[model samples]
Structures are given as structure tokens and as C-alpha cells.
Target: MRGLVTFEGGEGAGKTSQIRRLAQRLTEQGETVVLTREPGGSVGAELIRELILGGTGQFDPLAEALLFAAARADHVRKKIKPAIESGSIVLCDRFYDSTKAYQGAGSTVPAGVIAQLTQIAAGDSRPDITFILDIDPKIGIARAGRRNLASSVSADRFEIEGLEFHKRVREGFLAIAAAEPDRCVVIDASRDVDDVASQIWLALEAAKPRFMRNAPQIRLDPKTDALVDDFAQAMKAKLLASQVKYGCSDDWLVDDWEGECQAELANHVQKGDPRDVANYAAFCWGRGWRASPAA
Candidate 1:
């Protein structure tokens, strides 16, 4: 139903600002938008983000990469995956590409190592579209410096890196865009805010038919929310009963049934019809169950 869109670039490429604008525009268009950022989307990931960013040079290249992968694993499982499955357009400030660029290209970590770790962390969840805002490292770092000074905040680890390091980071992003042309859109980010936003919007509009148009029409009133909860519990109970009756002993499936059931509920809820919940009830409870005619 909904898709994940990520933004990536060097320091001060304005990924956060552009994400804000995109979320606002999408929300105004009646989309259910969940705005999140890498390294800190979930509670566990935020703690890891603080550890990684603040520790900075304390962690060696391999250790740092591992930390980032750990955080991403938590973020993807707890936040990003759920939002998209629930039919919310997820706009993330950064994602795995940043890891490859910063930890692989900008540091001593091997590209192969980064790729393997990214697979472990992100699994099958990848952005439907990625906007790579391109800018000169000199311009970006200067902008970052100015913003940090204005906000009375110290530069983060990546921002405080030397100009040459940032240049490597920029090259990394461009190379990614080159390799993954179908999923990556490189935008000129040296221009003013409005110009950058305009380009980003145009790209999103171009992608709408394929990526954004199929989201279920969610009429989420309080009653509907409650109905979702009720159906969820019913389906979970049914799943448990079926497993027991069939003498199934997949411990992992039993342990993680809540997530499985919720995913199924989300899939049904996004079937594009509001009355799909009524259908869901019948599906879960089988032949004996029927929706009221009014339902």
C-alpha cells in the first residue's frame, strides 16, 4: 500500500529540511505520512545513535559499522517496516546508503563488509524511492558549520570530518545513484530551498502512479481503530487454535505470531475498501461468521 522514501547526501545537503517539506506536501494531499530518520527511529535505535554519534572516533571502523548496523536493525524492524505495512508513506532522512557512503567510502571499512551488514540490518525492506541531493562538499560543510554555529550546537562526527572526507562521502553517494538508477534520483541541492523542494516534488509526482497511488483509503475513526484491535485479537486467537489443532510446533512462528497476525490484518485493512474489515472478520472466523448487512 504505502512506500518508503529516503533522502541521502553529504553533511548539510538539507535532507532533513527536504523531508519536512515532502511530508507536509504529502499530508496536505491526504496521505498518511510517517516521517522518521535513520540511526534513531525506534527507542533502541536512538540509544545506539547517541552511542555512535557521540563516541565518534572512539569506535574503530569495524566497530562503528557494527554499531550502525545494530541500530538500523532495530529501526527497520520496530519502525520503518511497520509504518509502510500499515499504509503510511514513510519519509526517512537517511537509510542504508548513508552507511555505505560514510562507513565504507569515507572510512576504512570494506565495501563488501558494509553491503553484508546492510543486508543483515535492513533485510528485504528497501526504499521505494531515494532522493540523493547533490552538493559540493565545500558548500555543504560550510552550510553545516553555519547552521551548527547558529543553533549553538556542536558538529556531529560526520559533520566535523575534514573537507576531503566529505568529498569522499559525496562521491560515494553519486556512485550509488549511478549503480541504482531505477531507485535513486539525484537532485541538485546547492540551489535555494524552494528550488530543491520543487525538484524533489517533481520526482515524487513522477513516481506517484507506481509507488504512491495504491495506498488504501484509510478512514480511521475511533470506532474503526477499535474494530482493528478487535479483529486483530480474533485473528490471533484463530491462528493459535489452528496451530494447536494441526500439531504445529514452529517455535519461532508461535513466538512471533503477534507480528504475523498484525501484518495480515494490515494487508487486509489496505485492500482499498473501507468495508474490508468486515470481510476480514469472515476470513478469520470462517464460514460460520458473517458481517451484518449494514457492515
Candidate 2:
């Protein structure tokens, strides 16, 4: 896949407008842009989203997270993945981070649970650049209310969350961006739309070096996410078990799984330097893999 970018913010943070302007700007510069949104991007995901954002409120926090993950699995697997694979400039409205904020921080769900679930639903497909639009919830909620009035619909489940919830969501976004400075950039969403778009464009320009240096298909999955998740359900535990089964020390796998991998998988690996080969191997094992003699 090509480059992936996502816009994250509270409701009415001008993500829609900024995404549109950026898509148009990039298209004018002779790039193919595929603009999409989450929770309701693809057909299957949209259906799940109705149950989620519809007024029923039957879904609890954990259920909401699962539903979002299920929808995300479809959206990324069917829509976002294909666009990225085709080398299009893919811009997504919201991604996994929203769950971290809304469900994890704003409610009773755990962040680690959200992380693990995101892996199952999203695989390893992460954005090349993530722009978190920072804004106050008070102004944002009013804007969202106005938007709902114009659209002739009530505020959605997340949009209708109270002020404190939105504040926690904002702080969550900032924390994420701060934690992953290389992949995330925070911008003031309280600014004018044009001003916000300009910052986004500048950041896009700034990220070109790293983005262009990577492989063509940065994050497209070759197979189904279900196939990936079935194996990854107990991925960490499985890896620890593999250490005992294979007579490799925890320290050995922790420190040198990269050095232990087949050369082919080695060349294709992404993630941090000294990539966790044990984790990757666990991922492979989940997909019905076995250890090679060389490994």
C-alpha cells in the first residue's frame, strides 16, 4: 500500500472540511487521493455503525469497542487497504485512536484491551501520518449540535457525550500524539478551517521524506484480518510459550528474534529497530505457521 494518513479530533473539529480541502489540494498536485471515514465507511461497517451510533444505546462500552473494531476490520480490510495498496493518497477521518479516547479514556474499558482489539481488527495497518486536531469540547459540541440540526438528525452516540467526556477525549488524543511523535502531529483545531488546512498541508510536505523512503505498499494486508486475528488472539502468550517450547530464553527472544528469522521475512519487516521477531513469529504461528530448520 501507499501512504496512509488519518484525521482525529472531537466532533465538529473541522476534520471533514480539512480532509476535503487536503484531498483536493493533493489531487491538484497530481496525486490520487482516496478520502474515507470510519465506523461507516464500507457497507458492512456502516450497518454495524447504525447499531452503535443509533439512539438505542444497547451497546455497552466494551460492546461499543468491539463493534467499532468489527466495523474497522471491514473498513480497513475492504476500503482503506485497497486504496493504500493501489498507491493512492488515503486520508481517513477517524481510526483506532478514537476508540482509545472514547471507550478507553472516556469510559470504563482499559487501554490495553483497546490496543489488543485494534490489532485484531486493524492488523498492523497504521497511518504514516496522524494529525490530531486539538480543540476545546465546549466550542466543538456547540458546532456539532449545529451540524446535527442542519443535517436533520440527533447527535450520534459519541458526539452526544457530556463535556467532561469530550475533555478526556481531547487529552487522550494529545497523549497519543505525544507518545508517538514520529508518527503523530497535533494541530490546533480551534483555528480557522483554512488555517487548519494549511498546517496539515505543511505537515504532509514535512512527512514526504519518510513516507517516500518506505516501500510502495506501506500497509495493505495480503489476506483477511480474521485469518490474522485467529492466530493473534493469544499472540503474546503464545510467544512466551514458544520460548519454552523452542528452548529459547525469554531474553533471547526478547533481544534477538530478529537475528533468528528467515531472511525473506527479515527484509519485509516494519516496526522499530531490532524488531521483535518473537512477536512476528507468534503472528506467523497464529496463521498456521511452523518453525523452519533455519529459524
Candidate 3:
């Protein structure tokens, strides 16, 4: 099967250089490779990129996120999926992970909203393997600044974001790697280019066998489980409060209570894995929220 390989990192992580090198190596091995980047993979996406990276105009965080999701949707449809279907390996310099890390983590957008947007943008498609080049944000931004200085090009919006912003981005990448250890390989981008490439190669070698097998299942974190429980309790509390305030009869109570519970569950379901969460939501929706019978 054709594979999708994503290389992700903060600015100055040498993602561009390394991806180019990897593309060459793969091409030399007689594998067809399509190399692309996020925010501008297609023509429409390129327009969105101009708006996002120009720094000339202010855009709300959620608005920017929606723009990213729109671009990604088009890119996946026009470029990535077609390439993979044609037996070509797609090597993306960045992808959805960048959005989650940069826009979701760096901006004021709520994480839940970003998660839902990501699900919609990606649909059923996800990278077969992801290579996250990790480095200190300070070092990375310095490297990027030097490169910009050498090229006599002004810093773009993202490049102009101070070290702290980039630091958050770095942390975001690491968090993603931690969350999806099986799919994400963290490489030390602070090392020499050759060393970084070697690490990537080793990672790919190790991952090849797994890729050939069925897709790996993702495990839920205990924190996520706790969040679910907290949501349920909150729903229960809200329903009880509403019941006391409105003084509704049993029929009205069941209907209104169930509606409120479903709404709360829906909000949480959007952010979390829909497996158990969906089941729980379905159970709650089917069995209307009812108070215990009077003693």
C-alpha cells in the first residue's frame, strides 16, 4: 500500500532540508515520492497561506484555524490522496499536526474546537508514519533567523513570533509524540544533518514492519477518562439545578434533563475519541436522565 510520511517540527528544525534529502533517497530507491507542505499544497490553499503568513492583517484564532482546515481539506483531496492512490509515497514537510501544535497550542483557540476541525479535515486519512524533528526552540529560532538574515528576507508572521511562541510550538510537537508514540518518531534535530537523517532512516526501518501490518490502535489516556467522568458529573449537576429552578413535572424533567445531558456529552464527544464516549452518549440519550424515585 502507498504510504504517507509526515515530517514535523518547529521553525529552524531543518524539516525542509531533511525532507528534500529523504525525497532524493527514496526516489533513488525507485519509489515515487511527492513532496509538499501545509498551508499551501493546492492553489486555493496557497491563497490561504498568503493570508495566514502575511502578518499584514489580524485574523481571529478560530478564523485562522478554519482557514487551515479548509486548506487541508482541499490538499488531501487534490494532492495527498491521489498521490497515495497512484502508488506514490507522499512525503509532506508538514500537515495537520502543525495546525494542532501551532494554531491550537500557540493561539487562543480551544483545544476541543481544534480537535473537531482536525477530524473533519483529515477524514479517515492519517499519516502512515510521522517523523517529529525535536529541538530547543531557542536554538531553532536562532537558526531560522540566521537563515532569514543570510537570504535577506524579512521574517514572516510566524517567524516574527518571539521565542516563547516557538517554545510552545516545540512543546506541542513533543506532546503529540507522547500521545501517539507508536505513530510518531522523535528525532534529534539539533544534531548534524547527516545524523538526523540517519536517525530518521533507522526509525523508518523499525516502522516498516509495523506499517505492513494492520494499523495500530490508539490507547486513551487516563486523563481523558477523568475528563469524561467530570463531564458526566457536570451534566448531572446542571440537570438537577435546572429541575429545582423550573419545578418541572416528571415528563418535562425527563425530556429537558435528557436534552441537557446529551448536549454536554456532545461537546465532550467532539474533543475525545468517539469509541467509548460515543457509546456512553448513546446510552445516556436512550435512557433519559431520571431522578431517583422519592423515598
Candidate 4:
């Protein structure tokens, strides 16, 4: 029953409580669950976590992003990778999407660069499923304040942030969920804990069996790579031809290619062709405006 599931949201989204509940239920089902969180799951990572969260360092957004990447690299090497390799069902309170929301889309950092940093940190390892808890920023902020007032710990940098920041983070999370619908599930955190947990359980029950029964690390052969390359090139060429057909400018691109992209990825995924799936994902990820230095 080896797999990884991550819960992500703004502060006061009840991610911690919901994750704990899910972990307890799964453990009772006789699964070995490795419950953890980021940016500090491993010991070394915890040190970094304190430096970031405790506000001792008070680093800028970019520096904080780098620190997070470092901590995540260590966490993956020391804890997450090992647990999953041992066939444990790993439930994480937060993961890469936190960085993506807080530091990337919600901040000044380029989302592409953050995406690259994440790739470097975790390699090809990605969460098998991610749950994004959606809630109103106003209610969420008040809830977080009350939590801080009640708990032993005070509000850290992120929790101390203003309403606008929380709103942006929520939008960032929603964007991620929209971009990767298959890999992410968005639940309305405004609902009561029981209802949210029930929805989460339904999602888990549907997906866990597939992961446990058939999850395997896929490696593509040279022939498969070539075929995928051809397919990708063909897609690109078709898009280019479409531009010519429509008499578009050189800098112009499709306004809404996501539907086609999603359909293609879903096709490969449904066919259970891992090589094709990997290729399709890689191609789709490279979509949108690419960086090009001007002369």
C-alpha cells in the first residue's frame, strides 16, 4: 500500500485535523501510514523549518523559496522516499504546492522558476494525490487568529500575513488544482470537519486500491521515447500549423489549449501506458509563454 497523499491550503483550512483523521482511519485499516509535514519532516529539515517559520532569519520571499527547496530535498532523501519505498501509505499535511502557492503564484517569484526548483528537489517523485482545502480568506484568517490565541505557538510569518496574501494563496492553490485535476482534489473546507473528512475518505477509498495494487515505477525504453518524441513533435507542429492557418503573429499562441492537452493526457493515463503518460505530462507542462532573453 505504498503511496503519498498531501493536504494543502491556507492557514486555518483544517488541513491538520483532516489529515490526522484520515491517517487514523487508514491506520485502522491495517495500513502502515507515515504521517508527516513540510517544510520540516526530517531532522535537518526541521532546523531549516525553524529558521524559516520562527522568523529568526526573516528571509526574503526568494531566499525563503530556496530554503524550502533545500529542506524539501533533505526531507525527500531522508524520510519520504524511504517510507514510500518501504510500502508505507504516507500522508503529508503540506508539500510542494505550499511553496507554489505562497512563494510562486502569490509572490514575486516566477512560477516557472519555482517549478524548476521543485523538480530539482524531488526529482520525478510527485504526490500520488493532493487535496486542496478551499475556504474564504476572511473566515480563514479569523480562524487562524483564534487558533494562535488558543495554542502554545504564536502566529508565524505566513500565519501573520494579511488578508490579500491569503486571498492570493487561495487563488494560487485553485489554479494548481485546475491545472492538474487528476492529481489534485479540491474540497470545500467551509464545510464541517465530518463532511469534509467523509468526502476525503471517499476519494481515498477510490484511489488507494489502484495505488496499492498496481503502482510501479515506470521506465521507458528507447523505442518508447522515440515514439513519444514523435508524438510531441507532431503536437507542436500541429499547433504551429494552426497559427499559420489562422494567420497569427510569431509571438502568438493558442488562447485555450488546455482542453486538448488534458484530453491527451487523460487518454494516455486511461490506456495505462506510463511512457506515453510521462511524455504527455512533460509536453503539457511546457505550455504557455516560455522565457526568451531579448537582444
Candidate 5:
């Protein structure tokens, strides 16, 4: 089941760390996870990230909102949408909610304008769940500053903003969470890292089943279906040939092999990992399929 999970908060709210932890957990459960960030993710969006984050006071509030929306449009179309279609759970660092918080509340941009831009850019790719890592603006800023200094990375445009700006951003996120209780989970990020992560995981565990149940069924393109079918036939042939080669095979061995092959093919196709299907085909075509010692 593919899901779009987003993390939103003020600066240094531990979004990166928590996102990684969640991704690892999901991956361990055999989910295909795509970790990405907004203002970036796609190539064009990344260029916009460099332009927007690298420059200070270059864009007015409305312009900044527009820039973010433009980047988000590219990101959704190029990266987020494709990954979801391919059955990958996309864990995003930020999404349009950042535009609503930073550009709308933290700046002079109107909420209506921000919403319009977000809808246009994001289309139907709304997040399945959003984690608002709430923290005091001052503490978050200090943490961001220390992180930048330690990594020898200069403060980006928003990181350089004053305390009042960050405070507004924090409030913005909180307001969003309150407005959309069903979609958002506000995590108290001031707690210990493990505590915060535990809260997040618990919330995710509770919500994931519902999201998966509501997720659209996996649909394969004609080309992909054809590829899967071809691989299925080829794998069956290879397994039968191997059984014949090893003359001591039981009469039902080839039937068992075919059933197993079909099961694997169904699993791979349902997961929508075309690469896995191709790799399986390659494995069966190579010497590995026939190099086994007699059993």
C-alpha cells in the first residue's frame, strides 16, 4: 500500500531524523519507501530550492509563496506521484503545508492565495498522514543554529529569520493541525528523541491500516502486465527444464515449481516493483537457474 506521509514543523523540529526512523521501520516491514523533501525532490524543484534557500530577501512574501508552489508542482508531478504509483510509501520532509505555514502565516501571503496555489500544484496528491513536530520556536531555532554551525552549513533564508517569524511559523503549523485533526498528528518534539519517535510510530501504526484500506488498488499498465506475463512463462520454462535436467526429480516437482513461480510473480506484480520483476527474469535466464547440483 502506497502512502504519502509528510512532516511539518518549525525549524529543527527533528523532522529529518524521525522521517528516517519511520522509513527504516516501514522498509523492515517490506514496504518500498521513498524519502524526499519539498522545495526539492525533483530536479527542477531542487534548482528552485537552491534559488529560494540560497538567497536572502530576494523574493517578496507572495513571490516566495509562488516559488514554493512552482517547486511543489514539479516535485509532485515528477517524484511524488511516480513513487506512489510504483507502490512506494513516500515519506516527505515537507509538503504544501510548509507553504501554508511559512509563506502564509509566517509572512504576508493570504491564506486563500496559499490554498489556491497549493491545490494547483499538489493536485490530488495530498498526504495520507502529516506529523507536526511541535516545538518552542526559540528552542527549535537554537537547535537549527547549532546544527548549521556543527555541519559548517550556513543558515538558509528561513533559518535566518527572527524569533517572531519562527514563532509565527510554529503557530501556523499548530493551527493547521487543529483545523485538520484527522489528517495531522501533533508530536511534542521537545521531548526526548526516543519518546517523540515512539509517539510518531504509535500514531502511524494506528493510522496505516486505515490508509491502506482506503488506498487505490494497484493498477499496472499494459506494458508492465505484458512484461510480467513474459517473465512468468520464461520462469516456468526454466524451472521445468531444470527439473528435467536433474532426472531424479519427482513427477510433481515441475508442477510445484510452476505454482511457486506464479505465486512469486503475483507477489511481485502486486508490489508494483517492475525492477524486481526484471531482476527475477534475469536471475532465471542466467546460469544461476541451471547451475544447481543434482538433488
Candidate 6:
């Protein structure tokens, strides 16, 4: 079973502090915990973070979204999957929801694009629970400013955004929590740190057992199901077209079709579920190809 928990909020919402406390608590309970944060989990992602937050270059909103998705793809493949497969409970500071809130909220990028990128990057994985720390933007900005004063370096690009932007970010978090109430639990961050942590712990307790029992599942609406089916059919057609175009069925099997179909199966089928694999193979065979001994 794989479990992921994420903490999200505007600046100065005590997300980092709460994550630390929770990590320690889980450790005490004999759970192997991996504490990580977005846009910095892997080497490639860390480089992207520097480009995003270092204030050195200008990035359009869509470009920024794409960069974020690229980073997430690398992070999930390198760090998140390995840790989860090792049976560690992963506590992430932020995840793709941050991108949706920050880049898709009011920017030029549409929410649909962000959602598609997140799905491709995450490959249907989702956090077991997400904590949204709600707080007044004015208070949060002031607190963040005070905290930044203690650091040696100047404020980064996002940190330099004015109060209005921060206010929008706060509103963005609330909107996200409302939209995904089942996955997101909103905590009043105006309360004391211990009180906020208690709220998060309660939310975790409610979600932990279910998360630890299964891999996270993605539920598709009709539109999304149609889109996925279209993608699969397109891929299949491309393989058949290549076979016809090249007039080489042997090369189709050796170099193209079988590998492509298997990759699709590996991606869409549940891991370690042999029944799904067999079913997928049968479906492919019924479509056209004769099953060989090797297949």
C-alpha cells in the first residue's frame, strides 16, 4: 500500500512546521516516513525550482505550468515511487494542487491544461489526504515578511509578489479546498500551532487506514473516460498505420506494435494485478493480433 499526505497553504501558514511535527509523530508510531517537498525532490526538479523561484528569468504562465509538470514527472518517477514502494508513508509539503492554485487560478493558463498535465505527470496517483491551512492574507504576509527578514538571501520571485497576489493565493487555496472537499481538509491557521496540528492529525487519522490498504485510485468522469479511450485508440491506430505504411508486419511486432501495446497496458493496468494484465492481453488479441507463445 502507498500513502501520501500533503500540506498546502499560502505563505506563513505553518505548513513546514506542521509537516515536521507530523513526521516525528509518525516515526514514533513505527511508520517509516519520507519527508519531501515539491519542485525540489529530485535534482532536475531542484534546477527547475531555481528557475521558477530565483527571480533571474521571466516565465509566462503556461511556460511555468509546463516547467512545473516536468519537475513533477521527474520527482514522481525518481523519489516518490521508490519511497512509496518501500512502504514508507510520504509527507509532501506541496503537490500538483499548488500548480492548479497558483498557475491555473487566474493566470492565462486554463485549468483544463493544468489538470491534463497533472494527470500525465502523476499517472493517476494522488495524495491520500491534503491539508489546506486557511488564514487571513494580511496576517500571513506580515508573518512571512518577518520570517524572510531572518534569511540572508533576498526574496525570490513568488516571495516578491505583492499583497494582492498573496490574497489571491489565499483565495485560491480556499477555492481548491471547496472543490475537492473529500481529499482536502481546511484548517484554521489563525489558531495556535498546536491546535492546527491537532486538526491535521484528526484528518490524518480519518484517512490513514483507507490509504494504507490500497493504491490511490482515479475516478474518471464520462468526458475523461472518453478522452482516455480516444488516446488509447489513437495509439493503437498509429501502430497499425505504421505497419501498413512500412509494409512490414514483422517490424511492426519487433519494433513497434507489441511494445507500444504493452507499455499502454503497464501504464493503465494496476501494478501487480495479474488479472488485469491477462485481460488486457486478451483484449488486444481479440482486436486483431494472434497470440504467440512469446506473447
lDDT of each: 0.79, 0.76, 0.77, 0.79, 0.81, 0.75
Clashes of each: 0, 3, 0, 0, 0, 0
lDDT of 4 by residue, 238-286 (tens): 5445446654543333444444444444445445345555554564454
- Candidate 2, 187-272: lDDT as tens digits: 99998888888999998877764554333321327675555555444554554455566645323233323332333234323222
What is candidate 2's TM-score against the reference?
0.72
How far residue 208's Cα lies from its native spot in candidate 3, in Å, is: 1.4
Model 3: what TM-score?
0.70
TM-score against truth, every candidate: 0.72, 0.72, 0.70, 0.72, 0.74, 0.71
Better of 3 and 5 by TM-score: 5
The candidate maximizing TM-score is 5
Q: Write the per-residue lDDT of candidate 1 for residues 1-295, one digit (tens) a residue.
A: 2789999999889999999998999888777899899789999999988888776588888998999899999999999988887778899989999998998888899999998999999999888899999999999989999999999988887787888898888999999999999899999999999999999998887665455233344455786787776765566565455546653543313332333333444444444243454444443334122222211
Question: What digit string (tens of lDDT, one per residue) describes model 6 on residues 94-207?
Answer: 999888877876356798899899999988668888999888878887778788888655667766677777777778888898888899999999899999989888888766
lDDT, candidate 5, at 149: 91
Q: Once superposed on the true structure, which residue ranges of model 3 sit more than 4 Å away at CA? A: 213-295
Residues 23-88, candidate 5: write the lDDT tens digits. Answer: 898888777899999889999999999999999978999998999999999999999989987778
In terms of lDDT, model 1 sits at 0.79
Off by over 4 Å in 5: 213-295
Superior candidate under lDDT, 2 versus 5: 5
Please identify which of the two predictions, 1 or 2, would achieve the higher TM-score against the true structure.
Answer: 1
Clashing pairs in 6: none
Better of 2 and 6 by TM-score: 2
- Comparing 5 with 6 on lDDT, the higher-scoring candidate is 5
Candidate 2 residue 195 C-alpha distance from true site, Å: 0.9
Off by over 4 Å in 6: 215-295
